[model samples]
Target: MGISTKEGLDIDLYQNKGRFLYKYAGSFLENAVKICFKSRFPESGSKRIENSSGVRPRMFEIDCLVGNDAIEIKWRDATTDGDHIIKEHTRLKSIASSGYKPIRIMFYYPNRSQAKKIQLALSDLYAGLGGEYYSGEAAWTYTEMRTGIDLLSILNRIANERGVS
Candidate 1:
């Protein structure tokens, strides 16, 4: 055999591509979620196209024509592991044989730990350069979506076990 190098199966890609551009990544994932809803929604008539409003009800309307239910998009870099990403996806999956699909779109971010969390709290970040939602409801349950990896889920699970005690 010849001398082997670690270049082929190396996992150091993280070091260089650490922080990702959420604006770019969000656009890509937005397209992916759009296609998913379009295909899964119930086909009462020919499918139509539309854009995003960053709300659940907006997604539910399309689900009526198709079958999708919701769309959750996330942009991350390095903190959220690939495995954790997949696990978090099951939040909307069916557990019962007769259960309906509650999920429309569940986008994920691969590595956004040390960066800003994934919640829709602050109206705008980076001194408002990234922008924020100026209209509509000021506070929704969406605030809980702020956790990075499993922090949110784990906290929820524990609190649930306590049963408001």
Candidate 2:
């Protein structure tokens, strides 16, 4: 089962001039994954962990927790920077080492070919953590809470609705 929301998700909520849009994009990805969780694990007691609004340097929050699993959804595009990538890798490694089942969902545009190259470049960052890299086509399975939900389609729908080309 896949999540279906009635209202349109607005990417414009995070649109700003000359900004990386990390927070906004993170929020959007969290919400999207939460929707998938709700539908897929309706009885698993899974939910998106909420945090207080406002910018704080040390704020800690996991994207979603399902049956003792810590899942994070990342929307990686061509504009993604090295610093943010390293930060996320460190977080995932820490979470896994702490005994949580760390699952990372990496969303990329265009196709798996390009996404694979990007994934390979990040291997060193996640090295020694048994991190497995999958192409975009196979990424959904690793990050999915349940089968049959097309996450890429949901992303495309959001992009289309937001007129993001």
TM-score of each: 0.25, 0.51
For model 1, residues 136-156, the per-residue Cα lDDT tens digits are 112112322321123335445
Deviation (Å) of 101 in candidate 1: 8.0
Cα distance off (Å), candidate 2, residue 63:
1.2
Error of 2 at 13 (Å): 18
Deviation from native of the Cα of residue 16 in model 1, angstroms = 15
Q: Assess each prediction's global lDDT (C-alpha) against the native.
A: 0.31, 0.56
- Highest lDDT, which number? 2
Q: Write candidate 2's Cα lDDT for 1-165 as tens digits.
A: 343343222333334521545567656765776777767777544343322322332344566666666655556544345665555555655655555565555665434575455556555444445554443566666545353577767778988999998
Model 1 RMSD in Å is 15.4
Off by over 4 Å in 1: 1-20, 42-68, 75-107, 110-165
